[model samples]
Target chain A: GIQVEQSPPDLILQEGANSTLRCNFSDSVNNLQWFHQNPWGQLINLFYIPSGTKQNGRLSATTVATERYSLLYISSSQTTDSGVYFCAVDRTLYGNNRLAFGKGNQVVVIP
Target chain B: EPEVTQTPSHQVTQMGQEVILRCVPISNHLYFYWYRQILGQKVEFLVSFYNNEISEKSEIFDDQFSVERPDGSNFTLKIRSTKLEDSAMYFCASSEDGNTEAFFGQGTRLTVV
Candidate 1:
């Protein structure tokens, strides 16, 4: 099983501020995704980047598979962005595709 | 976009009672999974189902827990006897395949007293 660790467990940012969250994994993964659990508890899919970089609106993510680390970047943050951001990964061992999630980075974007 | 849908957004059950959480995964998806998140804790995987059977399960999923795709479209998790610790937000997710991104439902909040 792979271990996922998210950094900056707690973050408070002013609206319009820019911030970055990181995720590190212990082993190689076949699948990686970034999710935002909003205040309403809806798990919104952000990105599924196993490698390279992807940008969606003011949000972007980069995963360096070789380095076993991924980063989620938020720019010009808004109050709506306040919630927990989780990074989950599925390792390739034994063809097991179940995801293991990180502790999550709790972000509070103050309006 | 198609998404996983869970029934009974919130449920309250007495300890020792059996509770079943239902979910309807995306129609085209082949892999389904159940995950739980205790308040103030990280999300943890419970089980994954494919081909009408469980592919993998975590230690958290013991004899008391079971999963079934009773119908072609419905996936359900059954807790034989609920406990106080069984209270959590249960999320149902589905993916097209093993190497794809999984989409999660809004989640069902289960509280066992």
Candidate 2:
């Protein structure tokens, strides 16, 4: 099983601020995803980057598989971005694709 | 886009009672999974189902827990006897295959008292 750790457990930023969140994994993974759990508890898939970089609107993510680390960047943040961001990984050991999630980075974007 | 859908957004049950949480994954997806998140805790994997069989499961998914794809479109998780500790948000997710991204349902909040 792989271990996932998210950094900056708690973050508070004003609207329009820019911030970065990080995720570190213990082993090589074939599937990695970034999710946002909104206030209502809906888990929204933000990205499915196992390697390289991807940008979606104000959110972007980069995963360096060889380094076993990933970063999520938020630019010009808005109040709607306030929630918990989680990074989950599925190792290639059994090819089952069972995801192990990090504790999450709780972000509070104040207006 | 097609998304996973879960029934009974919230449920309240007594300890020692049997409870079943249901989900409908994306029509074209082949892999389905169940994950739980306790209050203020990280999401944890419970089990993964594919080809009508379990591919893998976590320790938390012990004898008390079971999963079934009772129909072509429905996937379900059943807890034989609910415990106070079992109270959490249960999420159902699905992926097209082992290499693709998983899409999660809105989740069902289970409260055991």
Candidate 3:
């Protein structure tokens, strides 16, 4: 099993601010992703970056598979972005892509 | 953009009762999974299904828990006998390929009394 730890378990930022949330895994992984769990308990896919960098609107993510780490960046954050961000990894080939998830970074974008 | 759909937005049952949580993954998806998150807690993987059998499962997925794809569009998780600890928001997700990205449904909140 792979262990995952997220930094700054909780974060509070203004609507227009920028922030970076990090995810550190215990070992190499075949796949990685960032997800936002909204107030309605919906897990929205934000990024699927096993390695390299990708950006989408105000959200971006970077993963260094070799180093076993990933980062999610939010710029000019909005109130709607407030939710728990989770970084998950696929460490093995079995189980329909069984992913080990991090505890998550709880973000609050205050208006 | 394809999205997974789940039924019974919320469900409540007694500790010793049985409950089935249903999900319909994207029509073209081949892999399906179920994860649970206790209120204010981290999301935990329960099991994954592929090729009509379980590909993998976590320790939490015990004898009391089972998953099935009884029809073409539905994947279900049935708790043979619910327990208080089973109360949580259960999320169903699917991916076109096991190596690609996954899309999750809104989730079914299960409350066991």
Candidate 4:
């Protein structure tokens, strides 16, 4: 089993501010995903960057597989961005393709 | 974009009653998955289905739990006997491929009294 740990379990960012959240894994993984759990508890997929970097508008993510860590960047955040951000990893070699998720980073973007 | 859809957004059942959670994955998707999130806890994987059979399942999916594709369009998770601990938000997801991106549905909140 892989171990995933997220940084800053709780984060508060004023609207229009920028912040970075991190995820560290104990071992190498073949799959990695970033999700946003909305207020209503819908898990929305944000990025599936197992390695390298990807950007989506005001949001971006970079994964350095060698370091076994990934970073998510949110710029000019808005109130709607307030939610729980999760980093999940899948180790295919382990029996099933189950994703081990981190505790999550609870982001609060205040006005 | 076509997305996964689940029915019975919420369900309440007795401790020993059986419950079924239904999901309709993307029409073109080839892989399906079931996950549950206990209140205030991390999302946990329950099982993964593909090609009409279960490809894999987690320890939580004991003999009491099962999954099936009754027809061409529906994928279902069945719990033989529910328990208080089974109460959680169950999520259904589908992926274009087994080792690719997965899209999740809104999720069904199961409450076993």
Candidate 5:
């Protein structure tokens, strides 16, 4: 089992602001994913970066495996971005490939 | 894009009653999983199914819980006797293989009283 830690457990931002969230894992992982839980409780896939970087729309994520950390960036945030963002990882040694999740970072975006 | 689909977006059951949550994983996916998130808590893995059997399960998934792929397309989680603590958001997910990214459904909110 791997341990995941997400930073800045709570965040509040005005619309159009930019922010960055970080995830730190305790062990080497074969899979890492970022998810956004919307108000309706849908877990939307944001990124599946085990390493390297990726961007989609206003969201981007970077994973530095050597450092055992990942970063999610929100550029020019919108009110719709308000929700809980979670980072989950699959340990390389774990056979089942079940993800271990971190306590999410709750973001509140105000208009 | 292919995605997992869960039935009964929400459910309410009396304690001690049996409840089954259903899901349809992506057609091409071979790995299926069930995860739970209690209100204000982090998501936790419950079980993973492949080859029509459970490959791994957490301590949270005990004797009272079971999973089945009753058909080619349907995967279900059965709680024999629900308890108050059984209430949570249950998410069904699937991946093409054990090493790939798993996609999750919208989740079913189960309330046991």
Candidate 6:
């Protein structure tokens, strides 16, 4: 099984601030996704970057597959961004497609 | 955009009782999954279904738990005997294939007493 670990378990940021969240995996993965669990408990997909870099609006993510690490960047954050951000991965060796999830980074963006 | 939809946003059941959580994934998606998240805990994978059969499951998905695609547009997770620990937000997800981005539903909050 692949282990997914996230850093900065807790974060409090002022609105308009910027933050970076990191995710490290123990093994190579073919499927990696970033999700935001909102206050209401709806899991929203932020990015799907198994490798390389991708940007969506004020949020962007970069994954260095060779190093087994991924980074998510949130710029000019807003209060709506307050929630738990999770990183999930599925190992390349197994095609089961079950994602191993990180504990998540709880972010609180205060206005 | 098409999104996964789950029924009975919240369910309350007595321990030792049976409960069935239902979900309707995107029409074109082929892979379906069920994940659980305990209060203040991370999401954990329970099972994945494809081609109308179970593809993979975790240790947490014991004999008490089962999944079925009873129809073309519906996927379900049934627990034979609910336990206190079974209380959690159960999320149903789907992807086009084994190697694609998966989308999750709003989730069903199950409370077992």
Every model: Cα RMSD to truth:
1.1, 1.0, 1.1, 1.4, 0.9, 0.9
The per-residue C-alpha lDDT of model 6 at residue B14 equals: 100
Q: Write one digit per residue (lDDT tens) for candidate 2, span B16-58.
A: 9999999999999999999999999999999999999999899
Flag clash pairs in model 3: A95-B56
Per-residue alpha-carbon lDDT of model 6 for B2-111, expressed as tens digits? 99999889999999999999999999999999999999999999999988899988999999999999988999999999999999999999998888889999999999
lDDT of 6 at A84: 98
Model 2 spans with C-alpha error above 4 angstroms: none
lDDT against true structure, model 1: 0.94
Clashing residue pairs in candidate 1 (N, C-alpha, C atoms within 3 angstroms): none
**Once model 5 is optimally superposed onto the true structure by TM-score, how far is the C-alpha of residue A94 displaced, in angstroms?**
7.6
Model 5 lDDT, full chain set: 0.95
TM-score result, candidate 1: 0.97
lDDT of 4 at A57: 95
Stretches > 4 Å off in candidate 1 = A93-96
The ten-residue window of minimal lDDT in model 5 chain B covers B94-103
Could you say which candidate leads in TM-score? Answer: 5
Tens digit per residue, CA lDDT, model 3, B1-113: 68999988999999999999999999999999999999998888999899888988999999999999999999999999999999999999998888788888999999999
lDDT per residue for candidate 2 within A1-111, as digits (tens), equals 689999999999999999999999999998899999999999999999999999999999999999999999999999999999999998864446788899999999998
Give the per-residue lDDT of model 4 (tens digit) for A1-111. 899999989999999999999999999988899999999999999999999999999999999998999999999999999999999998784334578899999999999
The per-model lDDT (C-alpha) reads 0.94, 0.95, 0.92, 0.93, 0.95, 0.95
Segments in model 4 whose C-alpha atoms lie over 4 Å from true places = A93-96
Model 6 C-alpha lDDT per residue in residues A13-56, reported as the tens digit of each score: 99999999999999999999999999999999999999999999
Q: Which residue pairs in candidate 5 collide?
A: none
